[model samples]
Target: MARFELKLPKMGESVAEATITNWLKQVGDKIEMDEAVLEIATDKVDSEVPSEVSGILIEQLFNKDDLVQVGQTIAIIETEGGDVVVAKQEATPIAVADVAKTVETAKESVSAPANFSDSDKFFSPLVKNIAKEEGVSVAELESISGSGKDGRITKEDLLNYIKNRGNQPAVAPIAIGTAPVVATQNVAPVAQKAAPVSVNGGDEIVEMDRMRKLISGYMVASVQTSAHVQSFIEVDVTNIVKWRNKVKDAFEKREGEKLTFTPIMMEAVAKALKDFPGMNISVDGDYIIKKKNINLGMAAALPNGNLIVPVIKNADQLNLVGMAKAVNDLGNRAKAGKLKPDDTQGGTYTVTNVGTFGSVFGTPIINQPQVGILALGAIRKVPAVIETPEGDFIGIRQKMFLSHSYDHRVVDGALGGSFVKRVADYLEAFDVNRDF
Candidate 1:
């Protein structure tokens, strides 16, 4: 038998590393081909890593909660029928001068934190690197309270600590992989403390899950980063409603997908984006990034009550049938927790259907970098005055409120208001007799 290497597969272009959440197979366990061996979670999604060849799991290179780079060997599997393994010659030991020079270079640049491999607490690569750069000892790290979930230290927390740690001496670098940190310093906590909550004796205290924690951070960051402003408009969608009611059955039968209002709304949003290209842009510091492709982000609600936005690439090019298929596919996958990491990337604009939960209207926070997000309110039948050449009469009409939340910094009132108005106009003008 020969050994085969199991490596972490590339999840997406932007994704470089993932944290191992669980190990499904242990050492000496017999594994089948294409069976999942471990589960990994990136910043975007959680997924399983399957084995390449059927064999006994001989070794695991990383443990749970360890950050592993892509294309790195994660495990070793013994497989049948391969070339005989050959051992390499032993290498020479490092010279003393070379060792000193290496240490000097590390001191000048970035270095790995001492005893990080032996620490029980997980420090992300970023945090560990920052600690090394700032000469923060492991004991010092333990003393500083973390603001992240489960008391885990985040980059922001560490940076805040460093900034507030005025005129402190940089600790001497400890030998790598040698002694555990023995020095403890009295460092003032820099994170702003949350107001204490009063708990009743019968109240249940539940910690936020990993995804919820991440979402909470993102929402707070977006709010702090962008100047949020909203524009509201009531749309007469009686024609689009009648059109969908008429063709949904035929559309679903022919297309093998249910025709929903989401696709219809997405189509209109895509068109409005094309018409007013300024709204499809994202901000980068002092620069504006005008996206060439119209990728629409559909905000989907998960079964766990959390949210995920899976993107539809080049949405403007798809027809109504194609849009419906894409919408149904992404929505189903999102609910099933089967969406890949790339499906959540590259979004130029976003649309959320508050109508799903009977919300009449909502002021949604801007999905950051992207300047705008449109919230579709619930459609209701309301009485309105109808005017023709003959006379005016009272009529019942189906209408919904379009709430557009934009970054007031980049998108002025005119651009933000007109963009949503264009979307409403497209939906209001939808042809009742249009083909599927």
Candidate 2:
């Protein structure tokens, strides 16, 4: 058998090391080529590593929860030409002559049965302590199951069983001789009272994961470094909505994907970015970096209670169909927890949709060095005035709130407001046939 060493492969451009969260195979276990062998979690993401070749796991060099560097050897596998086989040691049976002696010795070591009493029953230390505190007999616990590891009795199990039994009627008291005396009842039923519900619910304190903690730190740093400003504008999306409905069926059939409002919004944003390039800029220590490329970042919510803003490269060059496919692919991958660090890096600007949750408006935070972030709110029907050549008419129109948060250090309020207005104008004048 030839021995092969398996090392951790590089995960992403910025990722250097990862922690071994779990091992799917143990030593002496047979594994196939390309089979997942271990799971690794980095600060940015988590991924599973597959085996390079079919082999028997001869030895594991690292333990679970161990931090392993990239390209480090984690295990050694033994391959048998093409089919690997794990070596197992044979066990010898015990002689029959020694069984009787062993049983006799065990019987002598075990204590004789005591008088029928509550203390004579077998109870774990924790259960015994709880029983003593509650004045409950061990006989009362015979009907309850032990929920602890290895069928051991736990305090919770006993307490819950007692609580359940307390709801039922009490058993009849045993009578003693001539005097008609009652049997000794040590345990008393606890009062059945419901827990008081608070008017305001308590907040849950959950520890932040590595990525969330990093993001929080970066947010605080950005606020400290830049002068943040926010501006809001309401846009009439009646034309855009009508145009989308007219072309949505054909677009989906042609691209084999459903067209979302995001791609349409992205097209308008790209045009706006081209007209007002200052909003597509990033701030350095002292210099402003105006990017020629309009790489738009879509903030995707992850399943792990974190957010990753993956950038679509050169979003300005892509058509509506292309943008839709790209957004669909990225959002699907992000939701599937498959995004790498590089996928989220090098963003020029970000767009967040609070409309998915039916939000009307929200002042979004500027994503770090980037000058601005656009927040899209839900569309709603509202009364609007329409002016004709002959007369003016009151009509219902679809309206949406567009809030833009920008860095005042890099982009002034006038420029930011004008950029948002330009986007709104483009959206309001959307055409199904016109290429943005």
Candidate 3:
């Protein structure tokens, strides 16, 4: 039988390694070519790797919840079925006492793996709890490196260890009775009563995800790296709204795409960036790097409670319709958990829409290294006077406020304000036929 080694596939430019989150097939299981073999999690995104050839799963090189480097052999399959040969490697001795001593000595210097533990513990809370529950000694747990929180044990680690125990078969109990009388036993209460109030409010502890921790670090770094300043402008988008409604149907029909306000805003933002190149720039350690192309990053909110900014590369080159289509596709993909790492990189500027959540105005933080971020607020109908050559007339018009948060290190208050005003002007004087 021909045996083939399956190596980890390249996920992205910045991604060098991934944690094996799941294995769909076990050793000796038959698999088909193009069948999903495993799921891997990188820092940027999670993805599934498919089998390249149909064969019996002879052996697995890495267990689930193991950190594997890119291009490493993950599995071996025998195409021409025969006896499976599993590669046996010597196990590392676990020095539990030494590890515990190290943890105590380097508590401040040590950081737990991102997934499993806090900075303090050698084992993450999940791993420690699992070991405690499973009655697995610390020495045994120490032998297994964590897939989360700096090689700290995760729940998956415990599960995989349980799976690898060939001596026992893991199974759920089957209920059998004359009439299958299922007891609705309240082993645990569904809800708990509140504790008695104290002078000081009771404190609650919450865990932070990797993304949140990264965001927090970036925010602090941004504040330290650049001097930030914000500028605001109110614009009457009545003309643009009217124009959009008039031509949206025909435009969609012709382009086979629904027009979104983001594309319209992107077009204006692109033009403003072109006019004022300072905004389309990144701050280096001691110098400013002027980006020749405008790669706009649209901040999209994921369905499962996380924020991702997917960049539309070379946005300046795309027309309004193209911009609209790109935004729609990226936003939808992001919500569907299909964004790749490349979609999140190389952004010169970012635009965040808090208006969708009924936010009238907000001062958005600058996405680090990038000079500026624009916050678009909800549109509301407000009374205003329109000055005409013939006369002045007062009428109710739809208006919106646009706020720009810029790095004062690169762009001055005047420049930032002017850029925002230019975008406002473009939105105010938008012509559906001409702009689109």
Candidate with the greatest lDDT versus the true structure: 1
Model 3 reaches what TM-score against the true structure? Answer: 0.68
- Clashes (N, CA, C under 3 Å) per candidate: 0, 0, 9
Clashing residue pairs, backbone N/CA/C < 3 A, model 1: none
Tell me the lDDT of model 3 at 82: 57
What is the Å distance of residue 210 in model 3 from its true position?
2.7
TM-score (C-alpha, index-matched) for candidate 2: 0.67
TM-score of each: 0.78, 0.67, 0.68
In candidate 3, what are the lDDT values of residues 1-436, reduced to their tens digit?
8786777776555455677888988999999998888888765566677788888888899988787766778999888655544333233222244333433433243223333321233453334434443445443454454554223466666657644644433222224553322122312222477897555457765689656765676677577666878889999998788888888998898999888788988889988899999789987655779998899999998766778889999998998888989999999999887787678878999999989999998888888769999999998999999899999999999999998999887799889999999999888878756746
Taken over the whole model, the C-alpha lDDT of each candidate is: 0.82, 0.74, 0.74
lDDT of 3 at 114: 35
For candidate 2, write residues 399-418 as lDDT tens digits: 99998989887788899999
Q: lDDT tens digits, residues 105-153, model 1?
A: 4435533446565565656655665576566667656656676534568
After superposing candidate 3, which stretches have Cα over 4 Å from the reference? Answer: 1-4, 22-35, 54-58, 63-65, 77-206
Kindly indicate the candidate among 2 and 3 with the higher TM-score.
3
Q: lDDT at 371 for candidate 1?
A: 97
TM-score for candidate 1: 0.78
